[model samples]
Target: MMNLILHGYWRSSCSWRVRIVLNFKGLSAEYVPVHLVRGGGEQYYAEQRRINPMAQVPTLVVDGRSISQSVAIMEFLEETFPEPAMLPRDPYQRAKVRQLVEIVNSGIQPLQNLSVLKRLNSEGWDSDRVQSWAADWIRKGLLAYQDEMDSVGAQYSAGDSITLADAALVPQLVNARRFNVEFEGLSRLVEVETRLMNHPAFASTRPELQPDMEK
Candidate 1:
């Protein structure tokens, strides 16, 4: 058995975070697809539910011990493996990297998550309206990120190398573009996301490459 089992949807941003970390660290694990759109999404399926009561995708099971939250999973992998480090070596710098990532993980992503969209749907919001909500939050959140980019520069989110922030940035950009949230101001992010798209680890993990993707 692969030591880790990733219960996630290919299109999920949170799931993508963990995927990037796994690839960056050269960790191979079982990919367990959970269709987040079918049958109201397999994340809600009873079996997956037992492992993750929150019914969220990107749940990482290590040695059959479950973990939730993308950042938590990222940190866990970093600690467990401790090779080809994903976080910066400097403690304060690493915290800064994490702070930038935090804005995305907690501040920005939740506003646009599937469950939030589903709730808006129950309130009679259409797809267009829901996407508008996503775009609104993403635009503002990324402007804040633009400031980070201005301070941090190109090679990294907080420093001159890939760190926690870069891992978080790529998938969020994908989501932003999907919702028509422009990346105009955050030029550095666009540059980085493009680079990451071609990167060996990032390229292989694109949502479109997943086994169950719809044509």
Candidate 2:
């Protein structure tokens, strides 16, 4: 029996990230879906909120411990499992991968996360406000990616093979597209996204393929 319980939303990019890492690491775990929109989300429910005070989906309950934040979950898994490595072994190379993940997780994802959107709406903001928030991050993030990728980007973020960095990037790009963030000028990152999308690991774990995705 798997001892891990992953509380996640079907369309959440962070949830997708953790799912890919679990798959890549050959770990078996139970998936518990948290509806992020229904009844104002099960994440906010008393029982679920006790699991994570942040009231966010993608909270991993592992070894009788509650873990939140996707990046932390990924790093914890890497340290705990440490085989079929998602990050490079070299210190500098791993730093590069970490940098990429941070850009997406902290710099990009937070600005466009659902909680923030809900807060915005509660404050009387409209769809345009939400779109603007998403656009600002995705556009600037793509530009940053383009500049960085100009020299170091090979077939992937750090090299010719898949890494945790790629794991982080692909999901957020899905959000960017879902939010209609324009990427016509940032061709390199777009190309990278396309490449990652074709990779079976990412392609198969997407929200669209999930059992609980709403219509």
Candidate 3:
């Protein structure tokens, strides 16, 4: 049996990133769904919070130790299972891949996360205002993402070979589409996302296909 246990919600973009990386590495884990909306979030429960103090999804348990954060989990997997590597060997290329990953992870995803939007709602922001808030950040981040891609993008976000950046891009685009973010000038990034959507490894882990995804 696999020693890995992954706790996450199906619709969570961060969780989606870890799922993609696990598939890319040809690894399997016992998936434990932590419903983000049910009962005001299962992550906040004491049991789940013990595993991840942040009360966030996508916490990974490997060899009896808990690892939080999707990017960190992916990095651990990359280091432990290096075959069919997702990152390039060259130092410069590796840094470039991380740069792209951070653009989505820190820049785009954070600004559009459910918690942040809900906080806006709690602060008396209407749905349209919340959407505008997300759209503005997503648009600027994606435009910046496109510019970075133009310099080094290939079949994937980084190059012909898939990398950490691709793992981050697909899910960010999903959020973008959900918010109706415009893509008028992001053809390259869109093409990369399109290819990933068709890729078996990435496709299988989509939110709709997850075990916990509501029908």
Candidate 4:
């Protein structure tokens, strides 16, 4: 029996975060695709809702307990399987990783999530307008990221090693592209994104390659 079961959508950045972590840790899961769009989002359906009241993807069920939220799930995985150590051992360095992670998780992602965009669409925003809204917020948050990277830059988001921040960043960059967010002058970010996207841990988890994807 598979010990870990992940409930996620192919294109969801939050779900992508967990997927990258799973791959980085050299772990495998029974991937249960919860289509976020079909049938008005399978996440809202009673079955998935029973696992995650928030009706969100990236829910990991392990040892008869369900864990929601991608960051929370990553933390759980870090504690249980700490060999590769997605976080640093030093408390301060770990906090730095979390800091960059939050800039993506709370700062950027919420502004353009499926629910928020759906609300905007229902409020009579056209596709272009909705894209503009997403692009605007993503640009602002990524600007902050760029500034931080310029200050204490490294091969990855936090430092020389691949930390939780890098996991958060690559997915957000994908979202930026999906919404056509222009991040001109953010060369450091662009470089890091390009390198990670091609890395095996990141490449194989792309939305297009997922089992649930149609194209």
Candidate 5:
């Protein structure tokens, strides 16, 4: 049996993405909490930096080999497990799935992540200003995501089946709600999120249910 260990924080959207993938694949990994805020961010410590050079959460250590970044970890798991696939088989469909995934992974999540927010704070941005900044970026990316959904199927981000796009979208929605980002024109995303959240993999692995979740 391959021993899998996941080092992450409860509320980190990237970490939450990996959690959803793990649950969807029915894989179990020992969870290790890395508090992103406590004591000036534990991820900066030498131990975690060694494990993940980027010092990011959702670092998947598989049989002693560590892989950082949520998308990378998700792909690794999908390629290794193969069963209960999270990506489509057709070339075009697979590319579409990756496009949607990147819409969230690359376009949306980074601007509002903890480190970026912390940097804004250091640069003298007040709480309200920082929140507004984050919300604006989220809105922009979500609008683009909504536009792309015209090509996707109705039920989920990509299609009727849950794909990597759904895994990426759900966690970003969580962050959107956190920043109070308006969803007026993004009804499709909201509807898709409603359906996705009902799935056991998404519902069970929510940040609130994680063992390291804070009250």
Candidate 6:
């Protein structure tokens, strides 16, 4: 029985991405809540910084070895528990899945994360302005995602099967809604998200259902 612990925040999209993979893979991890906003963000504390030098949520500690970043954690889970593979076996399909994952991970999430928003606030960006900024970037990224998906023309992000791309996309959609990003032009993403949300892995791991979720 390898010990697994997940340190994360309820509302973090990155954390949600990892949670989806963990649940989909039927892997259990003892969850430790790290409230990102309370107490000036607990992630900045020495304890969390030791586990993740980046002080980000969704740090997976497996047998005492810590791994940070949601994509890395998902990849680790996929590799370790390959029974329910999150990636396709075909090389081109795998690359396509990775490409979609990066659309959210690199292209969108970094711009709208809590730390970046907080930094914007410090620089005198009001809530409305910050949210507008976040929404614009999210829309840009998702539009690109949609363009890629249109080319693929599958049920999910990368393909018909639930790949790493679906895990990444669902959470970013949650954030997009939070920032009031309009979905009028993103019907494909909405349709895919609706389908994915019905799956047990996604439904069970939603932020609102988490023990640490705050209203």
* lDDT tens per residue, model 5, 133-199: 9999999999998888734557988778899888999989989999999989988898999999999
Best by lDDT: 6
TM-score for each model: 0.94, 0.92, 0.96, 0.95, 0.97, 0.97
Model 5, residue 45: distance off in Å is 0.9
Model 2, span 1-215: residue lDDT tens: 43888999889999999988988788867889999889967889998888888898788998788899888999998998988888899898899888888888888888888888878888998989878888888778867766655255578776887788888888888888888898788777777878887877777788988878888
Task: Write the residue-wise lDDT of candidate 3 on 1-215 in tens digits.
Answer: 44999999999999999999999889999999999988998989998889899889889999889999889998998999998798899998899899988999899988998888999999999999999899999999989888887355468887788898899989888889999998898888888888888987799999999999997
Segments of candidate 1 deviating more than 4 angstroms? 150-152
List the global CA lDDT of all models. 0.84, 0.84, 0.89, 0.89, 0.91, 0.92
Clashes of each: 0, 0, 0, 0, 0, 0
Distance from true location, Cα of 95 in model 4, Å = 0.9
Better of 4 and 5 by TM-score: 5
lDDT of 4 by residue, 2-104 (tens): 3999999988999999999999999999899999989989999998999999999989999768999999999988898997988989998888888889999
Give the per-residue lDDT digits (tens) of candidate 6, residues 28-120. Answer: 899999999889989999999999999889899999999999899999899989979889999988998899999999999999988899999
Clash pairs, model 2 backbone: none
- What C-alpha lDDT does candidate 6 achieve relative to the native structure? 0.92
**Which scores greater on lDDT, model 1 or model 5?**
5
Ranking by TM-score: 6, 5, 3, 4, 1, 2
Error of 6 at 61 (Å): 0.2
Model 3, position 161, has a per-residue lDDT of 88
Q: What is the TM-score (0 to 1) of candidate 6?
A: 0.97
